[model samples]
Target: MTDTQQQSPQARATARIIAPVRHGLTQAGALAVLAGLIWPAQAACIAWVISGWAAGDTALGRTALGAGLFALGGLLRAALDARAGALLFEAADRTIARERAALIEREIRAPGPESSAAVAALAVQKLPMLQPWITRYHVAMTRTRVLPLVFLVLAFSQSWAVGLVLLVAGPLIPLFMALVGMAAEQASRRQLDEIGGMNDMLMDRLSALLDLRLLGAADRAAQDFRDRAEALRDRTMAVLRIAFLSSTVLELFAALGVAMVAVFVGFSLLGEIGFGTWGGQMTLAQGLFLLLIAPEYFQPLRDLAAAWHDRAAGISVVAELDALDAADRVALIGTGAATAPLDGPLSVDLHGAAALPGRAVPLPSLQLRAGEALALTGPSGVGKTTTLAAVAGLVPLAEGRVMVCGQPLDADTADAWRARLAWLPQVPHFPDVTLADFLDPRGTGADPWAALDLVQARHIVDRLPDGLETRLGESGGGVSGGEARRLMLARAVASGGDLILADEPTADLDSETAAQIVAALTGLRDQGRTLLVATHDPALAKALDREIAL
Candidate 1:
């Protein structure tokens, strides 16, 4: 194993995550009831059969009566045990889900550069990996922690010496299982990483399929995908191998311990040892009960050890998510600057600041008035879009404050201020729904055709078989770039917000079509709506009532 894998903190974190709900008392109660009752139930039945046999009575009838009682006891035990298990399972599932959901929310709130990839990993990869682990954690809590403790207590009552040995030594079973668990945690973590890596590789390849085909590297991408898949398969096999080996080792130890106990009981019955002190020589019935219960006592141990794999795997997913979340945080939604309302037309002013990383472009702050259309013009590398983002409440201000209607915008209540704004990103994401749905916020029959007509997108819609009702598959499929941009603008218009921010709305359109989009935007200005459009189109910018040149 690699050194990094060896130093995994998964075990400690998993224990903390599960520690609170590991109800030993609950497990012990169920197990004690099951163990304490099963022995007498079996012994009583056996004794009845022996008596019927020796007395030459109907042994079958006596045996049937005993078996019927045993079955009832078993049924009662099963019900109690199942109820206990259900409690554990539900707690584990709920706790994990709650933690994961909170993590998701935190991630969304504290979005940063690393957030996109991290979120994708958590949503697409870690969630499924946790399923097996949660199941195992639930089972292990009952079997290893609760059942063994109960068994040791009962075994001591039966024979102090046997009980003492069990109470003192039986823990070695879980201790040994824990040793195996530590090893399995590493293996499971590795397996999960490999699986995530393979998934990422496949996604990367698929996203770049056109590039690979164009470059004549499709064969190479296929080979790389195969290698990744194979690596994952091999790691998975290794995890299975370790699980199998650990389970086998635990079973072997349990079998040996049970067998040794049986041998000692046998010798004591034959008077090979001083049994007078240890319950004065166990009866055949007592010895038989011990023999039968020995396996039951250790049964939970084996199950727990085997089930540890699932718990470890599940914990591994949580661990990965936790690690990613630790790197990025979500900005709290409601924690904007202050509470007072801005009184007049909004204006944003930012000073010298850097744009996105790797592009050290200096940005300057500019102001926009409420009554007119303000066009921001700049070169491609300039912060025109960044400036718009800052104004629209998307990007945080570096040095300056944004004022609306002559009052400074408050951070703590940005939501109230944001409600007055409408923003159409450079590339807006639309769900796989109808254009009509996008245009009609109420989802009722509002003629999307009017909005389409405004942006001159009606021509494009007419070409589509379904028109406004046409399903725009993932992210507006079957729609041209200009049509999609127009659709986004239409949605913004439908939102009916006071301040409209459009980023390069004309970016992929012909000059003639672009003019129509600008005209549509100009029409919003005529409606007393404050409009801000970031673009480099000289003619469009000159046509606007006011221009902010960065």
Candidate 2:
């Protein structure tokens, strides 16, 4: 076994993906071995009946007993095989569910830049490939190791010549398989990446359909989609061709091995070959039994060869998931902090705080008293947002200390500090739910209408036929930009936090709406909230208690 920590992502993923199904695999392997053991008995019974018939023994009772034993052994083997298949499929379902859950959870916790569309695609599309790998391929792999040896031992006990033929052919099968499998692995990885790219392209085009139509580029976009689809189909055919060739090669060797064993057994029974059966001539019954067991020896190897494609696809999926899990972007602080409501306003102090060392923005140190309002104004792209993000602990700090509520900000205290704050981002994300649900998903909070009224955005709810019950699309679809801003402001007002952070709150609004937003900010200040606003609006800045230029 390889050291787990030192293993590559594909290796690590294989280990974890198998852990949930380990017990099931063990049980299945046991059943398979039991079935293999039963096969030799069945073969022996068939040979005994055939030999008795050839000798012209008219003993009906002995023949009947041999036939009955053959039937019983065959039935037992079939039952074991069926039960093992059931166990493996059930385990496979559970394993897929567990892995998907982990991938989604990891993506949810990932930093903003690290959580891309590829992550979602891998979780939904790529991860399911592991199902076949576990259920069929992995089961076949275990049987290939166990059953072939059992058959070989039985064959050797009956006739060593047959055993030697199997031993020679079996090693050749894997050697050829290995050569084919290397090419298959590379093709499988490429195919997976191409499919992922296709998914992303389709998603992007669908999301931008309206824009493309308006710009008269819809025809070009459709052509691109067709081209990508064709390429994916071509790649898929390549993978299939390799898989079929591998199966064909294994089948050829297996047939050759079986043929050689059969010819050797026939010659030995005729006394033409004299070197295979414990230094004595082989009897017809023993020769027939060895012939019957020869094919069984090579069956496991053939099954494994058939499942090689699944192994390639599964390892590729694992590598993709590992890449998603390995993202190292800076994440939010205070995610695990205890929640405690603030009694009053919060005081924030940033000492020599700067943007992350290599970033473009370098923020200056600043201090604010409890219940104070400060506006951050500068030319565009001058670290205005970066300053607010650093203060909010949304980004990593490289050269300064942030003291909040008289305590230095660290992971332990970050959550508690964030609980007392409400942030209004430049771009808001809204799920597909009722307007009421957008305001409070739990449906138990301060009246959403009252918050909208304070922001002068009550007209938005009134205009909708469903009022607060009106459903929005993703990213607040069906709402205008100004309306979206007001909705976010309404949310912050309803949050009842002691600190409010607003970014460009009135950027696209008319003078009337901008004044209403300013009034809302003034209202928050009067309510003992410490406010930080990053903006370029002179009117909004003049209304604040203090101004800081980056």
Candidate 3:
């Protein structure tokens, strides 16, 4: 089997995402483990100085040498730790930046914004949790793997009794930590899921704030938020409890190990016990060295226990990344890049096209020449919007091809073809830009006033706080649905494209407003702009030259 296939699922996923950024990780982990190894030498220096004093051989130079060695080891260990931390954090920063950029870049051109909130949560909050895992947990694990064994060897060399106590206790700490880590991983996974759900709820609620207020459901929305908050709080607390429990278990075993070692070393030095030692005797130096080494033997275990939760959380986050990366969704074609308009006559043809993933819905072959106004009239769920998007190059086809401007549409031609099209979607969306910019989104130098006048939306802009300078967004900035439709028509007029695609533009508008929208669209046809409208409104469809009902 390949390396990743041999590992557990979470570990496989975690390693796949993290291994790419692990350039200096090995060196960093080596540095951290080396820092831990320094303690044994420092402990030796202390033991030497104490042994000299106990034997009445405390010459000034010998004592100074021991003190100097201890100080130098401390400084060297500190430097190693600091360098390792810098490398690890740098790697962590790179990893987060790379993942966040990839997620945003992939989602920006999607046909639907349905998962934007959850993706935002993943980008902003969940992805950063991997940082501590890379920086702390891995280093701790490396030290645990090496330092305990080194200390065990040193302890056995001095006295087997002390080594025996550590040998029994160290294994149990890791065994218990392994068990606790399972629960930790489960809790962390739930917490991450809760966080995504929370963001999704908040975004959905904010988008429908106006409707909720009008429907007298604001209190109900507030209650929903409170409930989600409570659930998140519970999930967070569950993780914290598991972390605290693991630490408590580690400390209990660590204390017992150290205590047993201390008692054995102390009694051996006092001549109360002699059988546990190799020489049947213990000197002050040996007793002191073993005592100093006792706590240090469990040091790596302590560090590992402390960072076990981070490993769990990091694995959960990586699994999340894997899920998002593997998820198969219907995304738009093209780089969504700005391009010069495709150079061709305005024409559209669909050859047995169907929406992505499957071809259950039949989209028959059709042809439309320049300056034609065709309506795709159909009931809901008849793939009207899908056909419009397919023609616009915003949705990919599974079984057939779309020709735009006499060119077969693919990634190579989608952006350029889209440059020549104007899409006025069912629910109007505006960026947080000035009204003038929104009117001329492509910066075609088209007169905003003229476009507004053509659509009869000039009166709507006159009521705005800043006229053409006013900023608005998807909520329409207090503009009603009909007004928003008129404004979008104005934008389409300003964009100065050859083909206009209007989707349910008058679906919820009143009779007068719908009539005005229909008039503006017919006016566009009079201007020789080809119109492909997806609509259920009979009057608007009848106004066009021909209709194709799906």
Ranking by lDDT: 3, 2, 1
Deviation in Å, model 3, residue 11 alpha carbon: 4.5
- 351 in model 1: Cα distance from truth in Å? 4.0
Global lDDT scores for all candidate models: 0.67, 0.80, 0.86
C-alpha lDDT (0 to 100) for residue 345 of candidate 2 = 44
Angstrom error of the Cα, residue 297, model 2: value is 0.8
lDDT of 1: 0.67
lDDT of 1 by residue, 1-550 (tens): 7554455466555554555555643563455455445655665576556556656777566778877888877777777667655665676667657766876676555554443444566675667555555545555554565556666665666676666555554666678878887777788888877766766677777656767898999999988888888888888898888888887777777777787778877887687966523547666555555566667677767767767787777777767765765563325335543334434555554454533422334556666666578888876657888776656555554444665655555454466666667787776587767767767754546667766666566777788898777778666788767677777877776765678888888875788777777887888788777888888788779778888777
For model 2, state the Cα shift of residue 109 in Å.
3.5
Using lDDT as the measure, which candidate wins?
A: 3
Off by over 4 Å in 1: 1-16, 19-61, 127-135, 138-142, 145-172, 191-231, 255-291, 314-343, 346-350, 354-388, 399-413, 425-488, 502-550
lDDT of 2 by residue, 1-550 (tens): 6387589755786687877678998898788878878988888888888899899975989789998998899899899999999998898888888888876665444353332566676777778888888877777878888888988888888778788888889888878887898789789889889888888898888867867998999999999999999999999999999998889888999999999998998888888999987778999999889888888888878877877778888888887766655555555566644477533347888875454423435786789876789999987767888877777777667667888888877787777777777889877667777778778633465578877877778988898888888887666777787788888888887776678899989886798878878888888788777889999899999999999988
Best by TM-score: 3
Which tens-of-lDDT digit does each residue in 1-550 have in candidate 3?
8776578866685566558866678789899888988998999999999999989997999899999999999999999999999999999888889888887877766523336789889889998998888888878888888999999999999888788888998899989999999999999999999999999999989877878998999999999999999999999999999999889889999999988888887787788886787885888888888889889889888888878888889889888876676666667788888999999787888976566543446675678888899999877778888788778887777777888778899989999998888889888888988898889888766679998988888899999889989887667977888899899888887888888989998987899989989999999899898998999999999999999999
Which candidate would rank higher by lDDT, 1 or 2? Answer: 2
Model 2 scores what on Cα lDDT?
Answer: 0.80
- Model 3 ranges off by over 4 Å: 1-7, 21-23, 53-60, 108-114, 269-271, 335-340, 346-391, 397-403, 406-412, 421-550
Q: How many clashing residue pairs appear in each of the predictions shown?
A: 18, 1, 0
lDDT, candidate 1, residue 143?
A: 54
